[model samples]
Target: MRRSRLTVVGNAVALPLLLAVLWWVASADSESIYFPSLQKILGAFPETWLDDGWGSSIIVDGVPSVARLAIGFASAALIAVALGTAIGLHPRLRAFVEPILELVRAIPGPVLVPVVSLFAGIGDGMKVAVITLGALWPILLNTIDGVRGVDPVMTETARSYHLSRPRRLIALVLPAASPQIFAGMRQGLSVGIILMVISEMFAATNGLGFSVVQFQRNFALPEMWTGIIVLGTLGLLASLVLQFAETRVLRWYTGLRAADHES
Candidate 1:
């Protein structure tokens, strides 16, 4: 197990290092205005992003982007889980709700940003709404599936023992469904990040996405690249956070699976 863990870690580190080296070597002598060398891009990263100090550009730009993502992602997760649980408990409600879900799902998320902007306007609210709406579907569907997929035997046993609804939920349903719920949340995080940028790109005065677009229009290619790198880094960090949370939350599930595998 230790060896396997080490191998996973080593592979993760090695692939990125190899890719970075390849990028560095391949772009070392490139003179294209659109595609600057990796060295130039790296050189520009500090001044481009950090500017006068650590907080200058990041304060104006990065904070809002990250904030929007967090708020939107959290809002979506909570709402989805709650609604999903309710719907999963009622077959009639699910039948009605699913048609609406399918209709909305057919429309792409980016299109909703402009429509949402019309009502919410081009403010933080609008951006957050866009992110929330975009990230909502995956989580909602998965939570519903997870809740409904709880073992019938387990549920029947709980009912036979006269377990209250809340007790059953607390002791059984959520635990059984958590793996799927977490999977949905992971996907939702990615969607939220994408929508964060897309919403800002569409209409915003200050944000990482807006800043990157501004850099592009002004031909600040290196700065644009730096903005992208920052976005990628944020994504990596967010994923790591989710992974840690999942590992802790589902430690019992992991142990059970491991023991079964060993048997």
Candidate 2:
């Protein structure tokens, strides 16, 4: 157990450590106007993002971005899971809606940014809408697939016991389909982050994305790099949090898989 824990820790830190070393070495003496040294970017970070009292750029920019992402992703996940359950359990409904779902999914998410902006205007509403719509597809489709993939035997057993629809879904179907649902959620999360940035790029007063663009336009390369680094850090943290949640949520599934392998 100790060895396993150590391995996990090492795996988590190895890549970041290596990348930090590489970045430090490679950009140590960089003179290019476009590519500032990592040190310079790090130095600029405090000044640009952290120095202002309660109104620091990081708080102003990062907080709203994170809030929009949370609201959008949460709304998307809840709606997708509920709707997918309905569609997945009904063959006729699935067949009727499949084509339209595919067509809508085919339209690249970012392409909707301008249209959403036009209708919703550039506000929190537009940003959240863009993110929710963009990230909805993966979770929705994966949930449908997961629900459909549940074993027929399990469904029969639930029916034999006279389980209510909601009870069956909660106790049987959801547990069985959780892994796939989680996979979809992770994909949706990544998509949400990308859309969050993209949505803010066009008509936004404050956000990491807006700040990045502002820095670039002003030729503040180091500050721009800081924004990029912040985005990367946010993505990594979000992924780690999701992974931990998934492990907890699917612990029973994981235990069963392990038992099967042992047997």
Candidate 3:
């Protein structure tokens, strides 16, 4: 168990450690104007983000972007799960809307930036709207698939027990479909982050995206690198959080899978 725990820790840090070493070696003696040394970037981190204390530029710039991501993602997940459930339960509805969904999904999310900006203007509302529309498809489709994939036997059992509609959905359907729903949510989050950054790049005043662009245009290479690093860190942290949540929520599933494997 101790060895296994150590192995897990080693595996978790191995890639990051290697990348850090590589970055340090590659850029240690670099003189290029566009590509600052990793040390310089690290040095610039405090100056750019923490110079003004806790409520510094980083917090000011990052919070809105995070908030937008959270709100947009939450809205997408809720709407997608609800709508997907409805469509999954109704074959006619799924048949009627599947083609339309495919057509819309084919249009890349970033492409909607200009179109959404026109109607919503360059505001937080527009940013959130863009994120929502962009991220909605994955969750919606995944939820639909998840719901449809639920065991017919389990569903029939619920019906046989004369479970009320709400009780059946709550006690049986949602739990069965949760894994898929989470999978969709995970995909949506990555897409949402991308869209959030893209939305801010076009007409936004403040965000990590704006900061990165601003730094690049101003030739602040270290600050640009910092923003890029921060974005990567955010993505990593968000994914880890989602994974932790998934493990907790799907504990029973995990146990069942383990038992099956053991058997």
Candidate 4:
């Protein structure tokens, strides 16, 4: 297991290093203002990101962007799981409300940015609301499916044991449904990131998205690229954190799958 993990880490580091080397070679001595050399981008990274002793862009822009993503995604996941659990537990309720859900999910999240801004007024509330709205559907739908698809035998067993509703939810339902829930959360995380940027694109100042756009408008290609790099790094870190949490939360599921594979 340790060897396998080491190999994974090695591959992750090696691929990016190889790509950076290739890009450095390819763009060396290039004079294109639009696509600056990777070297120039790297050179600008510290100054742009850490402007004025690290309180300029990264601290101001990047932090809020990530905070919005975390809040929105976490809220979406929590609300979806709760609603999904309740709806999945009742067949009639699921059937009745599903169409409305499908209808709402059909509309793209970006389309609602203007609408949301009207009510929320172009503040952090607007951005967070947009992110949450955009991130909500996938997890909500997946959680519903996960809960509904929990093992029937396990459900019956819990019933026979006369477990309380909360007890069953904690001991059986959630565990069984976790794989699907994680899948949804993974999908939702990406949506949340996209929305974070798009939400900041309009009527917002002091966010990573705003900074990136400002850089581009002024032809600060290196700084724009740096902002993108920072955003990408944020996404990577968030994904790693989520994966770590998933590994801990679903350790039993992982072992079961491994055993099945071996068998």
Candidate 5:
């Protein structure tokens, strides 16, 4: 534990130092290049915030992005888990659907951006659909892996005990499958964040992505840098939160391993 903590602290220290060096290198030649310095970007943040009406209209800008992400990711999760579970639990269903899944997963998410934009016309719905489509593959694929990987012993035990279908799923399968489910969720989340920004950048009038494009087009280099930094920070923060949640929720499985190691 102490070693792990030290390793974490080391990485935390190292990352900032590396970033600072990169920032300095970029700043020195910033006049010739499109890159802005860390300091300049930091300085621009408040002004950008103010100009965007962060006090009153932050919601107008931010809410749309957040709401779209939430809706799209939730929809993706529901459909992916449902369909993946069905496929995983039944060999026949897998045989029927795997080909279709393979084809859909083969297509890049951004390729659909034009199609979505054409039909939906830069609306929130289009953005949400893009996010959902982009995120669905990872979740669905991971879920299929998880469900199929559930312990056969547990399944047999449930059957021997005459467990009902719902009971078997809830008691015997879900707990066993939770780790994989969480893994899928993590993949989905990362992909969803990417698609969210992409959709906004290409299609929406208001979002962090839009903010980046707006600043870049206006040649506000510092503000553009600030937006990019914020987007990266948001993605990092969100991933971190999900990781923490996963740790908390899967304490039992993790703790069991820890206990075994101690023994």
Candidate 6:
């Protein structure tokens, strides 16, 4: 436990130190790459983010982008989990759908942006559709894997208890499958965030991506850098929160793993 905790702390320290060194190195050649100094970039963040009422713009753009992502992701989750559970329980359905799913997943998400835009017209609908397309497959595939991976003994025990179909699924399958579902969700979230930004960059009038593009085109390098940094920070925070939640929710699974190691 102590070693694991130290490892986490070490990584936390090392990553920032590495980033600092990289920032310094990159900025040293500022004359060539036109890179901003670390301090200058940090200093400009507040003005770019808050001054000129970019705060309002960010809120307007960011809120809509996030709302689209959330709506799309939630819809995808429900559909994926339901379809995945059905496919998992039925071998024929799994075989029938797996290839189609694989094909969809294989297609690059960015490629669909144009098609979605064409159909949906650079609107929130298009953005949500693309985000859903990008996020759904991982969750569906993971759900199938998780449900199928549940121990036979557990299923047998549930059946022996005369559990109803809904009760069995709710009490047994879901709990057994949660870890993999969460894993899928993590993957979906990563893809979803990327898609959200890409969709915004391609068409939106306001958003982090739009702001970055606006700054770049206007030669506001400091602001562009600030936008990039803020986006990175947002991704980092989202991933950390998800990971922490996953750990808390799967404590029993983690404890079981630890016990097995001890034995």
The lDDT of model 2 is 0.90
Question: Each candidate's lDDT (Cα)?
Answer: 0.87, 0.90, 0.87, 0.87, 0.79, 0.81
Q: What is the per-residue lDDT of model 2 for residues 172-259, given as tens digits with 9 covering 90 to 100?
A: 9988888999999999999999999999999899888888888888888888898999999898878877877887798898889999
Between candidates 1 and 2, the one scoring higher on lDDT is 2
**Ranked candidates (TM-score, high to low):** 2, 4, 1, 3, 6, 5
Report the Cα lDDT for residue 232, model 4.
81
Model 6, backbone clash pairs (residues 3+ apart or across chains), number:
0
TM-scores for all candidates: the values are 0.93, 0.95, 0.93, 0.94, 0.87, 0.88
Candidate 3 off by > 4 Å: 1-14, 52-56
Better of 3 and 5 by TM-score: 3
Backbone clash total, candidate 2? 0
lDDT for each residue of candidate 5 in 11-122, tens digit (9 for 90 to 100): 6457767887887777865654476567677777776765653331345556777788789988998888888888889999998989999999989888878898898888
Instruction: Name the top lDDT candidate.
Output: 2
Candidate 6 residue runs with Cα over 4 Å from true position: 1-18, 25-29, 53-57
Regions of model 4 farther than 4 Å from truth: 1-8, 53-55
| Best candidate, TM-score | 2
Candidate 1 — what's its lDDT? Answer: 0.87
Give one digit per residue, the lDDT tens place, for model 6 in 1-263.
56764685576558867997889777864653247787778788767776654542456655676688788778778888998888997899999888888888898878888999998998888989988888888999999999999899999999999999899898888778989998998999888888888888886877777788888887888778888887777777666667777777888888999999999
Q: Cα deviation of 148 in candidate 3 (Å)?
A: 0.6
Q: After superposition, how far is residue 39 of candidate 5 from its true place, in Å?
A: 0.9
